[model samples]
Target chain A: MNATEPKPTEEILESLADAKSVFIVGCSGCPVGCDVGGEKWVDEMTAAVRGAGKDVTGSALIELLCNKALVGIKLGRIVEQVTAAEAVLVGSCGVGVQAVGNMVARRTVPALNTICLGDYQGLWPGEERCGECGECVLAYTGGLCPITLCAKSLVNGQCGGTGDNGECEVSPDHPCGWKKIYDRLKELGRIDDMRRMIDPRDARKRAIPDAIRRTTRYALEVSEQEDPAPASEE
Target chain B: MSKLQQQLEAGKFVVTGEIGPPKGTNIEPVLHEAEEYLKDNVAAVNVTDIQTAVMRLGSMALCHMLIDRGIEPVFQMVCRDRNRLALQSDLLSAAALGIENVLALTGDHVVMGDHVQATPVFDLDSVGLLAAISNLEAGTDMGLDIKGNPNKLDGVPKFFKGCCTTPCSPTPEAQMIKLEKKVASGAQFVQTQAVYDPGAFENFMKMIEHIKVPVLVGIVLLKSAGMGKYMNRSVPGVQVPDQIIQRLTDAPKEDRAKVSVEIAAEIIRQVRPICQGAHLMTLGWDHCVPGIIKQANLT
Candidate 1:
């Protein structure tokens, strides 16, 4: 799932200072595992916003805050509470905040900086899994991503700035992306494959892709497909 | 016919040279180098188009200059700078200007160049471009224009188009698949990335044994052990064997250039029979060109 973390309460307060009343929103799936968005976290946030001298008009632990339909149905019931609040505090990823904003047509303030698609180690952010750049070149360059991991996103070849010990020159703590790719290709008995270059991605090929977008290749059915509605009476 | 094309047709061991366009309007640097290549009996000189993403004089201009001087020029076209229309226009102009032997390439990404801020307009990849070039030759368009001017153009360039290949890829099958696509798209020949390991290149060549197109192995001169290591660590597709790195390291700086020439000559001798030709890339060390050709005795 798209991983996220709770913004520092102080940071969220900066955007909420002008609002006398606020509504809290949180995600049920990823943010729950991430510890930033859950029933307990929503209560905590309500208390904090209340402590900041703002009234907690209403709040909900959204099943998936990024889901427009679920958000519409849930927020539709809380129309009076939503209108009473000056703004919303979304305790999920940026996508969730944007999704909430898109659904309610109200100001949605993100309480978390959406990080990479993550493997949540704990409630706090730890690791990034996928970059979601539309193209997945993981098979060619080991299981890691040079696009996000490497400072220079060098695809065709590695920059000549590598230190001999196989550490990234830009970040000493991080393992060099190209070195990792080289070693992985070597281990896979396919070192010669590094010679070929990945073509530049067509930025227009994939639009702001939703759950079940179809492309020339396989359809990426990220969400469950629903059966077609019975044809309308002629 | 272009000298490179003629030599390839004759089944001769071809030797092509490289000359980057001068960054400024200085025409002398390019002309002087072209004259040197001609004197060295270089079959053709491949003019780079903003190689390494660095801005330079257009390859087409230098090519025209060489053509006027009665020299064969292989025009290098990269997809990084131009969209399909501009690319197709240049292709037609290259043929109309008597420039044959075009090399289609997906140039270095813009971030690697001085003009990092410039937007990259890679409307097509190398394989896509080869297909476009073939379509252009077939009296059709790249299908980029939607208005359906599907009628044939008044003039079309019959280019002896070639494309670049990475012979020593980590995934040989993937490389083969793309190479097959390039050939299918009407690429007449292919010049590979600089090869250092004979065994690796041999395996790649073996996989590509069925293809009838000529494969000219790229040979970039290695000046020192440090450079070799740098390329090994950073340069994609190009790797220097540890032994060669050790060989250069064992030599003093004064003799490193000599050792480099000798090593290149040896590689040329070894791969001369296996491949169609040797594409000698004199990466700013043009003086060593004569010594390499003479030592290798490549025609």
Candidate 2:
């Protein structure tokens, strides 16, 4: 997610402009810990909507957006409320926005800007961590993901712009990812790793296509539970 | 002027402020802010303990830090974090260190903070904590066994205990009951939650005219219409009127800060005559406080 991309602000304003009732849905996953898409964001958003002259019916927080089973059970109750209202505002990650979009016929709007997927660093009071490149190079970088660190996202060698004091030229406080890598290797008694010139990274692995997929454990669980017999037994 | 001395000899209104400790060991900035308020001639500075359920450097340590800087700190001791023993120890330490002022509060729930699963320790509510402080002042712990003999702590430093009240509660009767309990539990002063509408504060003052303790009106600087509404919804005691929200909305983005200072100054102007003093909750808008004071003609 791009940090600057504004989320569904216009959608929220239009949907709730004349609405008599609204229900805010918050995600309990990524945004919860980051203090953005979770219940706190919902609370702040709900208050902002009410402040803007709208009647909020009530709000609820869901555990995970990708959990279709939980969403199926929970969305029905929320949809019942939304049916009476003009719109439903979602304060969740991009996944939550899509889930609610799919579940709630065509009415609900999203309030939050789905920024990124990093922990709350407090630089911006309520912004997400965005690791742009779709590559996980933590193993080679000594657990510090360089994709988010290096200003240029250089995977091979240290940039000439690295300051003598070991801070990045772009942001002095932020350490150069390559410098960090060099220091970590030196501490591990493996300085030779930096002396050898490494080849360029495979660009295809880092190329993020337009659409992402949820082919992980959450999607697998949903597909395996197509038959609801076991749920009935439980 | 010393806070107690100002309270004793009052002509001009007294000004008090709150400092929310940062959520880490990095307290230099927090201390710098406290020193700034102290330099501004504020009667007292309140150091909050785990405010809004967020953990920070404990109030006891921060209070000592303020005292070390020659600022009189009103140490805030919430019942949500510590039990009776820890509470008593902290109180004794406060008294020993000459940090006399104390504000007793029933802290926010643990779920509201960063660590949700952290167990809450609400062994005693605010009133009980006040009663415990009174007991400690009387030289007896909660167990009623005197350390050396009966009434031994008479020579220890005394605490100026305070409590909080929500002036804009939907139900005044319920609020009055809580206020009465606080007064009965040995609270000498009452600091209220944010008061946006002066009319509500006037009505509340009329309702509690019989209360003998000094009432300090809380004045929070409005950052935005969104912030005001958020506090009204999420924070338990605060209620910002629709007109204030509209004023903030109508204000241009560049002039919103000016409008906020103006609104806070107006609130203080309207309520100063009815209360003992005004406690400004800058909400991290520390730089605006001196401006608010000047605009309100409080200096």
Candidate 3:
């Protein structure tokens, strides 16, 4: 679950100060789990906005505010309110806030800071377990992410700070991440896996505005009907 | 730094030694080194915590053994693995087990040794580890709560903590920042990485003249030119000069040990006045240290 908390009432009002009318957007996914930006929070925000003297032209509890295509469709259903509003206030995480903004031409301001992806089954559920870096190294680490587990996030080697008790030399609360790997690999009888030096994370893969347009049946059908490259052009 | 600290505080040049514990349950190597060398000149012997990030016996357990054998074991704690919970408890455990001196280090990375796939936890660096020791000593945990929260009281554990630095770093200025930070974080004294170049060390000493802590210069006994060249290439921040490597290469195979001892003694004699003392790391050549000490007149 994505977690979020409501921004301070005063700060929200200050951001919405210049607008007489505004649109509120919340996520049904992550923000709802944290109770920071779901339907009730949107209702409470509407009341807070009414009290603060701004008109709530419209509000949306998007199924996934991060889905730009769905957002565009939902946004099309209420074009009038959106046109009437001077600005939009997003009550979800950073991704949600940006998603709504991408679908709208008007100014979009975030009302909630993007926390982290969380598990639903309550196994370290609400905390950020994975940083979701573009590359993943959990397979070699016995399902433990060295990038997220280790404190330094060193990709190649461990700093020799580990104590002998399989305890971390840094924080006393966490176990030595490498020791866990060692024991796991030892048990699996694959202690040689520890010698594999994971390559540095490729930054370009994580770069934003990147896209992957998967092959679809429609494209396949269109390609079937289309002629091959012209002989002269080829 | 407990015994060594007192000695340093008294303006006396104090020496300390280090021992790497055996991989399996063999206790003889550890005790033999302590009984052999630490009985006389060395103020304290540091029980390494998996030196080079390789698997080994626990430093705390070895410290307890050293204590049982009537030796002063400096319980070296590295931040590379343990978090505060383990570190704090180990501090209490060490004190309870009659272990006093503690050395803080940001251990070598796990990839350097036999275990390459190990997940390292360098939650705290060297300075952070030293600060953790201080936090534990102040009758509180890392979160600043009383040692035993919501329970009966126990005596506070006190430690004479020390930290390591690389004075001959490629960038000595940055090393000074760490040195000063370690001192600021309550490091009683400072031990350095292996020092082969005295000019660089004197330059380092000149830069950090105001730290006010005793600096125990690191002196490793180089057995051959191959060892010197390998150290210069493999070890982090340790640069063995070309002249020293050439000297080692020129020595006959039979005279290699003699040349190594002579070089170690000469380096000690050169750096002795500048540093508070030398922390000799034998690296399994404990027998050769006597020659180095004798030649340098440290006996």
Candidate 4:
């Protein structure tokens, strides 16, 4: 997640506005492990809402909503607990929230404004390490994700705002991502990779649209069962 | 009695302040700032060790510098970069320097620092560190053996050990258990994390009334509304009420500092009865602490 991006303040405020009984759901996926929205976050948000003079019905943390089996088990219990609540506040990433919405009744409200898929790393409180662009270019940049680093997210060239200190004009504390990519390349003795011009990123491929389906072996089994057999005619 | 013990026994409204040392060898500014607090006659001046996971001058060395300047220093020992041997050695060094007061803490993780490559040595957690301190005070090392034939300096070095507790913990039961462990490990005084809401602190204090040690409520001067929100989101067990944030937001740019001082002073004024005293974490704004103390009528 973008640590600098304003936290789920607005989402939390909006979630508790007209709701008395609230159920908080935490995500145990990417952002959660990095300290954004996990079991600790769920407890913190619950206390915050409760301190605001509202009754929190109950709270549950799902391990990974992307996993069908785990989601099925956890979401079943979550739906039951939140059944009596007026609203549900999910503290997961955007994808996790969409998955939960698919399984649950259409009343749960998302309390977290899911930012980017990344790690927050810096001396100061707010610094994100990764920005999950669908394309992977770590092979050229010495394992450093340049898509997240470059100020303009430029894949080919450096931004015009790079200063002597490698900091972007937009923010002095933040290093120009492209400059870091160049430095890392030089350090790894692979400066020749910098000469390779990159093309524009395909937005369609990068866009993580909601409700994605995975064609597992179970799908193949279902399709085989759907086919008419000679034994069925007998 | 030690100076801190004497001060506490006299029923004095103890005033302790924090000093964030600089990173480089240019220690003039740090010493100057520390002297400023010392000149104010604060009961004790705490020299922080690796605050916010950023490396700086060692707390033991800085505390020694303060002691040499005739100022009582409370050396903060965090279990982040040092192993048990180093921790024990540092504690022994502090005792050797006659620096009695210590604040034990489980330091921030390496991921939170600018130097992520640096290895984090969490040989012993805060609880274990506290136990080590207690053992040191009992004239034994971590191996439970007497040091130098057990007759060194008439007895074991007595330390006015302190540990931190967060009043804004999600569960008071767990927080109390941790606090009790600290107390059981020989914490003479408990310094809480930044406390913004009096109601929350009151509830936490009520839950831990059985612990007999004095609880020093941490009073952090709120810098800005954004800062309040940042702390609320990033740091666990630190909840800044929206009203406080709004108060900061409404203040003019130049008056923000004064407004923060007033807010901290007001919190201290209200919480003095419940807590022994306030541990002021000025967050590099030490000059305003005197003003806060004055405004709060804390003698």
Instruction: Evaluate residue B32 in candidate 4 and report its C-alpha lDDT on the 0 to 100 scale.
Output: 84
lDDT of 4 at A65: 46
The sequence of per-residue lDDT tens digits that candidate 2 reaches over residues B120-200 is 665666667777788787767766344555444655557888888877755453356556766877888888888898998
**Model 2 misplacement above 4 A:** A1-234, B8-11, B146-155
How does the DockQ of candidate 2 come out?
0.01
Q: What's the residue-level lDDT of B259 in candidate 3?
A: 92
TM-score of each model, paired residue for residue:
0.61, 0.54, 0.61, 0.56
Clashing pairs in 2: A117-A129, A118-A129
Q: How well does candidate 3 score on lDDT at residue B236?
A: 55
Query: Each model's number of backbone clashes?
Result: 14, 2, 30, 2
lDDT, candidates in the order shown: 0.73, 0.66, 0.70, 0.67
Model 1 accuracy (lDDT, Cα): 0.73
Q: Residues A139-192, candidate 2, lDDT per residue (tens digit)?
A: 233333345555544444343334445655445576666676666544544443
By TM-score, the best candidate is 1
Residue-level lDDT for B140 in candidate 2 = 76
**Which ten residues in a row are the worst by lDDT in model 1 chain B?**
B169-178
Residue lDDT tens for model 1, B114-214: 99899877667677788788888889875544666664777777888898887765545545766776787788988888888877888888889998899
Better of 1 and 2 by lDDT: 1
Which candidate leads the pack in DockQ? 3
Candidate 1, TM-score of its B chain: 0.95
How large is the interface RMSD of candidate 3?
Answer: 12.0
Candidate with maximal lDDT: 1
Write model 3 residue lDDT over A1-234, tens digit each, in one string: 444556677867876676788888777776676678567888988898889888989988887776667778998899888867877777765555545655775656667643323211111222224443434443344434455556666443234333334445455566656665555545545444444445435444333212222325324544665788668854
